[model samples]
Target: MTAITLGHLRDALHAGCASAVARVLDAYEVEVDFVDADADELPGMLDNGEIDLLVSAWLPRDAGFVQHGMRLIGLLYRPVYVWASTKPLGPIDTLTSEQVGRFITVSQDAPRLKAALATLPNLAGTPVETCDEEVLYERVSAAAEAGEALVAMIAQPHALFHTDMLHVLEDAQERLGGEMEARMMVRETVAACADSDMLDELSEMTLGNKVMSALDYTIQVEGVDPEDAAEAWQRGRLVPR
Candidate 1:
């Protein structure tokens, strides 16, 4: 039996996809191992043939991995970023560029923030403080409590976890007219060595719609385990190749 190695960022979104992919491979009687990897390390690992596949979030066009000789097989989801505040953010349209620029915080290399800045060129020079994901919510919430008119641009699913303390800017994506997507990638060598038919079936099942639905159900629905949700989705929606 061939042992296939898979890697993904350690997050709820990627975890769901990893689960679904694992189940799909199981049907083909393939041995699979899962690795939780940091985003920065994925490119290097893939380049060195450390993993057969990497399930990663969609990146900007000029992202390093795009030129790293990896093949993007399919999209996992189209994720948006929200400008969340601890206090109410008034009508997005009415807010002046300067008013919206009090301060904006984001994670390192966040595609949503990149898009937002591109849309609001006036905010290009606005203060952008970077923070690790674990403390991102706390930093934004603290800024709000300090009476600072600030917003944190964060991934949509992560915003849900901070809903108790933050009010998501309702039309942030509408204003930006762009959203980041998640995609599954594999090295060229891995792609050539693997089963193309199975890959195609997995890719078809890995569309943004199916993965996002699975994510929402696992993350928002009551009492559902992520692994179980992914397994159920695979059994119900996927046609074996």
Candidate 2:
């Protein structure tokens, strides 16, 4: 048990993880540090000990953090990059990779999408692969019109359309267990806390709490789950989201 500081992106994912930590470590009087790092810089903060752990939100896309002081505690959600297309894919259950594959661009969302696409026995093709997120969206937008080459992009805006022109070929999140996961970033500094015993006690207190929605938490050792306790804390304590 160590001081669990979180360097986060200020998203639901980050909030969710923080609350879970709070629930487990309340009695130890463990401090919850919130390091406000830009979404892109979160990994850096962990490496720098700016935060104790990144228990809230998505894991990194790159392997740069290998063997760092950080250790993954658990996953909260499956990250997703769904394909919403310009045309309606009728009876989607029968989709083939060739018919809809090209429309589903690949990037970091590949792992989740791959599992979802498996259900569509007929969906297969050379899905346009982009080197980065920006280009992936660009390609999807360009194909907005029929014979228009673009299929769909990673951004939510790509899914928004004036009419039925764009339809979700598949919900990446739904298909991927809400398409999100959480990992804790146990800082080297936090691990060396003078009060390590306090941390361990707190960790035991907050085990198996499902505090994943509405971004809130409450710490209680009075026989309540951590997530629900967190919800209470959010409602009664934390500032507005």
Question: Tens-digit lDDT track for model 1 on 1-241?
Answer: 3778888877656666787777778888888888877777866776777877777646663266554667877766676655765567774544555665454555664655666666666455766777775556567667766877676766655533423666666663475445776777777776777787778976876445434544544544333555776766666642222
Model 2 residue 9 CA deviation (Å) reads 2.0
Tens digit of per-residue lDDT, candidate 2, span 82-142 = 5566666644465555555464544656665666656655655546454443344345555
Q: Given candidate 1, what's the lDDT at residue 10? A: 70
The per-candidate count of clashes, in order, stands at 1, 30
Question: Model 2: which ten-residue window has the lowest total lDDT?
Answer: 213-222
Best by TM-score: 1
Q: What is the C-alpha lDDT of each candidate?
A: 0.64, 0.49
- Highest-scoring model, lDDT: 1
**TM-score, every prediction:** 0.65, 0.46
